[model samples]
Target: MANLYDLLAGGFPIDRDKPAFLLGDGSAVSYGELESGAAQVAGHLIARGVEPGDRVALQAEKSVEGVMTYLGVLKAGAVFLPLNAAYTPAEVDYFLGDAEPRLFLTDPAAFVAEARTAEPLAAAVPRADGDLASLIYTSGTTGRSKGAMLSHGNLAANAVALHEIWGFTPGDVLLHALPIFHVHGLFVALHCAFLSGAPMVWLPKFDDAQVLAGLARSTVMMGVPTFYTRLLANPGFSGEMAAHMRLFISGSAPLLESTFAEFEQRTGMRILERYGMSEAVIITSNPLTGERIPGSVGYPLPGVELRIGGGEATGVIEIRGPSVFSAYWRMPEKTAEEFTADGFFITGDVGRQDADGRVWISGRAKDLIISGGYNVYPKEIELVLDEMAGVTESAVVGVPHPDFGEGVVAVVIGAGDEAALIAACRAQLAPYKSPKRIVFVDDLPRNAMGKVQKNLLRERFGSLFMA
Candidate 1:
């Protein structure tokens, strides 16, 4: 595969004057205009001395400016590190120090005066086959954040695969509202859109009202489960939105079964939930026409290999594909542990593939709650809780127990009769699988990635289970 920019160049020759992006603000930019604007930005970065392989960090929201900044960094041959727009200044400083970026790009309104005084670096044409084009930081549930090194090849291959698998065409209008710093929005959304010459509708942040408006003209909409839940609650949601959509994809976090059921009932369209991460843009997705299972994330994408690693250690989902990141930046040991000898990326997720080829994610390998010597996946408990009346969300963790070694404890968000809810659990779940202790909270703690931080729950309530 050639450089990502080279792929853009081919698209450029086809019909450069065609519209490429349609902003939420009612403005549209043509591919010719975008290419020209990016070229100017690339020239500016070169004049400021940004060299190839050096990191250029972007701390901005989803806007035309943010898109330009990303393309500029890539065109200049520097690796782009797009930070979450919600990140604090201290968080920005951490990435700046870790990645050792040559330049920090920010929205003019958001720019801090200090960045202006930093020294500039030289820019040069990049080697398309080089090791690093982007350094994406994972949520670091295990510990501190580690940068996943994505090469030009890794990104290019993934984008092409998605374009083929999803049947994306140049005329497809993709509605994007997720944070661009993550793979769901960056690779699966933007990169795929760009490679296919698909037009994009951009929203700076997720707002149910804004999303509903964009869906008026969009052919596809992609988001996490939380986004869907919020949209379902909106009074503006009508069956018409589903009629205009060709594909509706979900990822970054699991789609709760209750949320899926509610969405389909209201809009008359079953969402297509897929599985992906920062390491590999996407591993699997449900078929376009076949059964779109409620909780299953579906089969592997074209050119992607997946399987459950069985024997002694079962249920660990492993992947081998062109889209997989080459390694974790500056962490050889950690990268070595994440891959198998044959080059499959060992995903931390615990899942199983059914005979029909549908994939069901049970839980995270690290989040497994071992109570009374039996392994209990938290997802099972959460699923049960989500189905119960009035329960909005739930988190299950292992609490200490002197008798059983560990006990199942559930932290939930709900109202009304607590005793009645427990009775409902008794009717459905096995006694051992039921929560030994239940705590009601306003909201569960979630990281920027929208994953529940069960570690925080374990730390705060672990002592309660002690004898």
Candidate 2:
């Protein structure tokens, strides 16, 4: 079987009775359930006329059913499109219009229940290396979302690389609290456990109380910067509590140097941070056994080619790797513009690489806001705010946030009602993408060329969240 599911499922323990997921209720979901559940889900899709290469969109809360549905989508050779559960109908409308999935699942539990009665499909659908595995929608600078097309080969290679580099084993237990809508939780984290046949102590979301309890039973944990900060704030998260854990990995947002240092001081362990995007799942990762440094994303994985663009000491990061997505869905021109003539994908991140090959990300060339590990694009919200009745124009920028890595701040050049504008945004965009604060201004600071100086706005309101 060429399906990505085959590759992952092949690594399962010979004894299917072994647990694959250890839930909070003291019960366990065995690896055998994954196999049978996926088969039935595949049968359900096939019965619904879903074919290989078709899209299957899912917008539901995280649960065991959600994980099983993801596996079922792969087994059926369909592209899995996972949307944020927080997305409003307005935001979800755009994704549904763009991707046009053959089946849209809003109720994962019901779908799994329905799938249980379907005839089991004993084998996975054959998928070629170039066959699409997923469509990850990332908002563009133009306020439109582009679905990054990931292939089976792309995921398999990245999963294998990450599984090997992370030193995962059957004995390791992963503490999973991250959302599965995007790459971090959906692919990077899940693949590691699947490849090693390791069980995950699954938590729906990051809660201080639940995580503290889960940590005691887990050996390896993966999370974003916010998770670490929240855990640190809890008095219960002492070094003694995390002493049983072997590794703590962080990514999906920039981990503040202060938090990293403080976490080490409190826990007696340094959190390994990595760099990635929707285009490429995991580009660079800090070493497992070696010294993990603060503010550095460490070295690129084996077989990944990374270089700073324009031959400058510090410039845009460019990469060519098996894990990198081939192109934006249905946007050939856009895809062509993003890649260099030599085929390296422009990562749109401004950074530098040391002579020893370690990479340091200074900033993003694109004004992307990663709030609480979710990618929130300013242009997406700015477009909504600019069209409001009382707003002349708006500039959205991300400022420092204590819990969330960044907080969205909107500065407008009109006499718009602040509360009304925020309410409108909340109605249209997801909560994380909506502006936390709205500042009415006489005029937006602009460059001599008349372009809005978002940098200046960021500086002005940078202390709002911190203070």
Candidate 3:
């Protein structure tokens, strides 16, 4: 039986002495070392009575040991559920109550404090391609988070597709700094490197100085838009500094066109922006070899099909592919609602494909503000606000309004004048699309992946128009 673990293990370097991960603390784990560590962790998991299909919830800090735990869960034929380390105990309690995992892994101190115990199984459980590999919970911004059930095939297919598209080779060194709890970091980043036998320069988190230093020795760097923006702010980060680098990829949030242009001008390399969600590991990516458009998420990956539904030019983006997840864990009804009768997952994102087949994301369907019975896409207003002087980024949302039904509200991150920003919006956008109220903050509320928590923004200003 072909398992995802078996596929990943196939990429183990012929020379086992080769480094698998170069840790932040100046230690390197060889391919052979990683295999041994993973095997030991798998033994521990099996000994703890983890059976095939059982959920193993892990909420430990990002470390070499944590990645081994993930691989061990796979080797044990159990479902891996990696929760954000930043999640509070109450939030973890909710997840535990919801998933009811067979085992929970945390820090050593916390494990002792909880006083949980388990016994080993007699043997390792067998797994197939279609079996559940993971249950990654979505950020519960709008409502309760749903656990997207990713199958072994779903993960394997995505890894294979990315390995080919990104042209990952053993010669490449991945500068990994993103959180491992999310799809981008854990699946997309780690899988590509592991499947290609490529070594990774792993960091605890995104530190501009450390990343800049790492770039000298690293060939590939994958990060969010914020990472690029912060790097651009540093005078030390120059085109010469990244001359040895091969590729720079960005995702997890919308990459502002201005930021994209500025990065290209500074680094002399265009960031390859891609689009993906927890339901699908990676759908569309700006081509690795071809022209990487600044604003577009280039083209759909091999084996994935993308189409715009609802409107003529732009609507809800729908997808169907082997990489798409099977279902939302234990939420059959919600899962059924998310997919079309023909099997296409109705991705809640609103987007349009250009004449060249490049996809442009407008905004989320829920983020579209219907003010005065007029449809207003927040991305349109946000684009204008982001270009204004003194503005870094902006999030536009809909607030309840008695007459208009929903009024447009703009939350900005910079010290831009509210009246001037509103005036600027009025100059560019239609009157109904203009922000009725402008809220300024030092920073926008974001999830672990750097995506703006629009639902939280809505909740904060939901009653603004009512007043």
Candidate 4:
């Protein structure tokens, strides 16, 4: 209904006395404290000449100070762009240039001085109009990456919708260990927590022992599939340690059926798998008290609409919602291609909604592979392989994996022998997608739609895959 700052102000007054955030070291911040902290940071940005709709870049480790900086930028009526702390200087420079932030708010001691030099240049120019809220860059299946422009309205609606659908309330406590740069960590975790007036116990990163201890105090926790697997590995995991938790949500990558079963057996908490991306934070989620299917992404959240195309359960997932991002930053043609005439964001994820209204994700529109919860686009690897000789054609697909979730395997149709093909690819592609075992295939299966069916290839080489 209102912008992020407006909603925070209204909600703050009612829950002023409530605890808003709690650090891992047992430090707590009240809603009233959070409000003032944000304002103080907002004052810093305002003094630096930051205006409404101006971009502010944040690169910091996950901490109360970092969280406050994010909210403060939003409160100042400016767009916030949080870079992954793990990003190399080159990657950081690319994002800073693309977003054109007014301020690069990072503790300079943590990053190289050269990386922060561009911040001064970005701050020199000022922008007007309160249209832009964020510019999140996502790696494309193609070689080029695009920045999705999220508006104030789009972000505001999503936080509210999440609060309504997920039963978030003032009483809830979320164990926040997700990265602050990603939308799930910021929008769904912090923004939604703000709306509910709930307290969050923030952790810098996911650590099984640390998270297990935090779960002893908190009621809710959200993580990717990889988080659950690592927790299950810790022999200390028990039903008693998980008794205090209210919910366990999994997303950012597909939840493996084995991981879900193992988690339930150990913790007695069923992992609620959900679907989301940079374009639209989250679309579907398992209900608080309904059928919790193992592999499904659950039903669409409030204010979200989804439909399956081509009469296939695993067709491209189309979503229309207020939370959908406005467009690609400064790329009008690319923005138009991302959404349909009726305004639905065409999620490149190939998925199908079951009879029970649960969405099951199959794969991506490209050779995009999700391994260990990180998105690895195969096109990036293919481009590397294309530089090598004797490589006629290369197709990368995810094979069933036990440890890493999905093993990036390649089936190559080459001009030379197996040894030569492997040697050529070894010189180029990343170790993750460089084909664990390159099987010689006569041809790749293509349907009437001219789409290469990777599933067929997977079935053909099922013996080579680790079950």
Task: Indicate which candidate wins on lDDT.
Answer: 2
Estimated TM-score for each candidate: 0.92, 0.80, 0.95, 0.75
Ordering by TM-score: 3, 1, 2, 4
User: What TM-score quantifies how close candidate 3 is to the native fold?
Assistant: 0.95
lDDT of 4 at 202: 74
Regions of candidate 3 where Cα sits further than 4 Å from its true position: 108-125
TM-score of 4: 0.75
lDDT of 3 by residue, 155-175 (tens): 999999999999899999999
Judge candidate 1 against the unseen true structure and give its global Cα lDDT, from 0 to 1: 0.80
Candidate that scores best on TM-score: 3
Model 1, range 135-230, lDDT digits (tens) per residue? 999887667888989888888887777777788787788998878778788778887788777788888778888888899888989888888888
What is the lDDT of every predicted structure here? 0.80, 0.88, 0.87, 0.72
Point out the worst 10-residue segment of candidate 2 by lDDT: 445-454
Q: Put down candidate 2 lDDT per residue, 63-105, tens digits, no spaces.
A: 8889899999999989999998878899899999989999999
Off by over 4 Å in 1: 108-126, 312-314
- Tell me how candidate 2 scores on lDDT: 0.88
Residue 26 deviation, candidate 2, in Å? 1.1
lDDT of 4 by residue, 1-467 (tens): 34567665555538587777777677777887666666666666766788887888888777666766776677677888877776779878888787788888776233222322223221212222236777787743334567888877777777777777788877788999888778888888887677777788878788887888888778889887667867888888888888878889888866666678878888777888888888888888888888798868899988789987666645678999788887888889887887888888888877778777788776676556777786666545545544455554566777777866777777765655666666666777555656566666666675321235676777777666554
- How much does each candidate deviate from the true structure in C-alpha RMSD? 3.4, 11.1, 2.8, 11.3
